[model samples]
Target: MGSAREALLDAAYEAIVSGDWAGARMADLAARAGVSRQTLYNEFGNRDQLAAALALREAERFRALTGQAAREAEGDAGAATAAAVTAALTAALDNPLIKATLTDDTSGLLPYLTTRSAAIMDVFREDSVAIFVERWPDLALRPDVTAEVGWICETAFRLVISHLIVATEPVETTSRHIAEVVRRLMRDLTTT
Candidate 1:
């Protein structure tokens, strides 16, 4: 049942990404996933829940990308972290599914992109804490602060990326400035 629920959500999302906003309709989603309309309602509650699920799933992908960036920060933590952060920001800006997700005019996709998907934000923060701790164990006095730092870092990253991606701002113009700010923030706060 869980697998079917996920399959329905995946199908709904695929339709959405391919410019089939109408397919996000509960009946269409059910048909696409070979499920009954009652099943969708029973499992996911409503269309909005389905959309939120899809958003969360996409957020997981972003988390995976960040995890890759963190793993790359293995030994030489500072330089590697700076590079990873820049790369993560770039990926968030360039993510195609995110672009399409934001393009949905009906479901208020932009707010969902930031607000409802906040759960995944926590996932990234926790994951980054582990990665950063592995790289810079002595940086924090209490050990748990890495998650706090990561949350700030990701929030700052989202601010810049949201502006650039949604507003089509010049990435080159803002990248260096944002990079410096993030660097200083991490250096100042993370050091005990």
Candidate 2:
């Protein structure tokens, strides 16, 4: 059994999934979670807060999936990086919220996730860095190299995100390109 906050988040996610962010009303979310609007307000403060919470929760979920992909690749750094990128790309392609977030029109949630998401982006990058450092400790090289690797990994993430947003080519092609980049990065790091 989760807390009211988690339950409310779940309800909010379901509402957002079933409909759209704009359509997910506070009353509906409250009713879905068996809570009152006042309780929802008290828990999340406002709709913007609720949206932020939702985005954070989803980011955590995506990071977990990416981390699992890295872990599943065992100790092979290149494999781990490629696996993580593949998982992220696949998830982005499959998830509606991600698709909506990258799209230009509707949802009104894209800016919350992209342009206005410095804090969330920081968290996302940190999480990815942790995953990379865990799987490929070489990424933790001398003097803040971990930060460098983290930024590189985040760049790959952004590239994949861009591919999803642009929808210019097949996901497989973008995934292959990212995997190659990760492979090259791993090679360069290990060689240096």
lDDT of 2 at 179: 72
lDDT of each: 0.66, 0.72
Query: What value does the lDDT take at residue 16 in candidate 2?
Result: 65
Off by over 4 Å in 1: 74-82, 89-95, 139-144, 147-151, 167-176
Candidate 2, 61-106: lDDT as tens digits: 8778987887787655556766776787788878977765655254
Superposed model 2: Cα runs more than 4 Å off: 74-78, 99-106
After best superposition, candidate 1 residue 115: deviation in angstroms?
A: 3.8
Evaluated against the true structure, the overall lDDT of model 1 is 0.66
Candidate 1 lDDT over 1-192, as tens digits, reads 988888897777777777786545778878889989999899889777777777777767776775686577544444544555566567766765676766666544556656654665566666666666666676556655665667755665466546634654455445545556656666755545
Best TM-score goes to which candidate?
Answer: 2
